[model samples]
Target: MKILDRYILTSFLKTFATVFVILFFIFILQGIWLFIAELAGKDLDAWLVVKFLLFYSPNIVPLVLPLSILLASIMTFGNFAENYEFAAMKSSGISLKRAMRSLTVFIFALSIVAFFFANNVIPRAHYKFINLRKNIVQRKPAMAIVQGQFNAIGNFNIKVDKKSGENGEKLEGVTIHKRLPGATNTTVIRSKTGLLRSSENDNLLQLELFDGYYYEEITTKKPAERKKVPFAKSSFSKQVMNIDLTMLNNNDMDKEQIAHTNTMLNLKELVYTIDSLESNYSKERQSITDNITNRINLTLSKPKIINPILDKKIVDTTEVANTLAERDSVPDKLLALFDTNEDKNRLLEIASNSLNSSKFVISSGQNQVREKIKSINSHWHSLYEKFVIGFACILMFFIGAPLGAIIRKGGLGLPIVFAILIFIIFHFINTFGKKLAQENGIPPFLGAWMSSFVLSPLAILLTYRATNDIGLINMDNVLLPLQKLAQKLFKAKSKEAK
Candidate 1:
């Protein structure tokens, strides 16, 4: 039994390792393609690119590890069943559960390691990956400028029709648009030929143009008085410009700012964040409620009634009569309210004020509500994700192992298909649930574990079928009824035809 356990364990681990490497490499290549725009044609150093990929590699581990586990489990168990090893073990009075015990223990240990990786290692890797990418994005203007496109360096937009020479230092048909500070007009420089170089310290870009024209538009103080806006143009045989690189040089963001992001926090940090956010939300809600209540009370307490009888009448009775005397004038009945309308005006003013205050309160309340929901969802998702990823690995192993045994097919052909289909379903459910949680449509725990809940029952069913030596889909039971029904229908049709 010990020898048998060792053999199965060894084979399983070997398959796991092989699948993990293959999948990881595939995903790494995919990442490169995904970020090709950012990485390619940037003239980045080879080592910098390699380091960026290395930092980003850990981000894929959580996604790929579970997938590899699924595939490897399926292949290992399918191969064993295909070779009749499981039958031999059963003949020796070893039950399926006993045969799986060693592998199950090993899987449990792997889950623990996976959890630690997700908690400890992945966060730091994420931080480094994000900052490195940001730094790469902030590479010097010379490195970022591409030919035949408008490239922004500081406040200037530069375009080169063609770039040549060994280091791309020679430029042709160069155009630069420089916007002056606090001015609407842009300084445009067009050159038929140019030479480009960066300072030794890369603090500035030196562009020297030949046989070019410079144009600037000056805005007049009064556009209506001027027939045309003033403008200046100069044809220059030689021109030089230096673009400051100070903004691009400061590429590094505050480390603390990056570290505080949700992706860069581990389980412990996530828990702390959730607690802090919950506390803050509680206080904010309390404050909002109190403020709203006080505002409402003040609005309600304001004296809104005015005595109309004591107010002076603006129009006399004779004037009202004169207005009534004119046929085209408004009738005295309609104009009567104008003679004593102070109270109505006061009431209208009070109502308008109350409405405005109410609108402000409602708007503030809605904003606070949304902010609270977002904070809570973010923290909760981060917290459950730590455990969910780890548990998913174990659950996937159970599913794949039994499924493979029941199917009794080995190698990549069927196993890979089944693994991918199952994983797709899992990934889709997990994503949908997370979105629901983020939107506050469901509890965070349920949303986080929704995938596991859905797959667990299927895993149990597969395990049961494998243990009983039954087909995965019970094809005989399913197809027998359909076959009988078809035969009966065909017999009835033939009789009718006869």
Candidate 2:
């Protein structure tokens, strides 16, 4: 290897390693901050905490690696340009492309490594990380209930406005919803103040309440009876309830029960899962369509009449049409359909209920379709993200190296500023595109590659300008337009004054 090539490679490697380690640590700290609600005051073992962070660290690599490469490339090449090394090379006839040859090869190799890491290592890590978090919640059930949020514990959903005391055992304004089996209504229990207590020997958490109320809406199998809105209510000065905590002590921490998440799947798994999901989604949609078709295109058959003289039933062909056309609409029209006003009212009531039920079914089906579309989009996004990481390395390097050469600035001053601004733009576009894709606003392919498509031209433009030894921005070209505009405005003001 030539001395110049070796020197450039070593310079970039040193800067890259430094920047990567620093950024990796910084991002890890941010992760800790994000999950502090689950981690803080949980009394987790030190080693368990370390393991959680270790499993989480791999997911941060995709975010850090590209930024590091961009910053490192800019710093290295900017220093070369600023320190006259590039000038010397140019004097001896070494062109910009020739200087970039070795670095480009290195980046290409790095991109491949990044692809494999994202495909294999990150998925496994994500699987483990999510399992670890779930197990933590199971082992320490108290930690699952963060302040001011509804949390499911045992058979009820519990929420508290405030939790005080050293161990957060004293609660104020506590509310609980206990749902009955196979029922839609919930029994509500509310308290002004509550106390939580437990012991190591017992597998139950006892909740003691003061100044509470118990309210439950009575439901019945008959819809007519249920419309009366019957309810049961009572007041209590104090009450004690025992919530079982045996499930929290389960020893299945190593079990991979949450493997169906999108992040846990690789290319092959994603393909299989997406196919299965689409098949199921298609069947569900067809079922809904058929139901709607049946409801909308319903036809009433002719009524049968009894003939006392012949002692046989006779079909009244005009019965349906005559009944329908008797009145303008609804209850009045049902007069010919039923002999009594009471029976006619009943028929009208049934029709109203059926129409309402159909409306509910259609609304529910629409929501289900939207949710499935989002799930499919998420899977596709995950599938493409693995490849995007690798391409990003090449993309960032091209932009950074050329930009550094064109600007002729080194160190952590202007280079750092440029790297940060460029990276922010890249990251923002990536997030926006992904969000749009997840919501089905755009195709997943376009959304996943949006940032790359937007920035790739900048890389090419920078490389071209640097190769031809053009300034970062031609000041004369920019200033000429502004100068002419200012002069024209000044002339206009002078004419107005005259």
Q: TM-scores of all models? A: 0.72, 0.84
Q: Candidate 2: worst 10 consecutive residues by lDDT?
A: 299-308
- Give the per-residue lDDT digits (tens) of candidate 1, residues 396-442: 98899998888888899999999999999999999999889988999
| lDDT of each candidate versus the true structure | 0.84, 0.89
- The digit string of per-residue lDDT tens for model 2 on 136-210 reads 776766656667988888888889999998888899999999986688777999999999887655788889999
Which numbered prediction scores highest in lDDT against the true structure?
2
Kindly report the root-mean-square deviation of model 1 from the true structure over all alpha carbons. Answer: 9.1
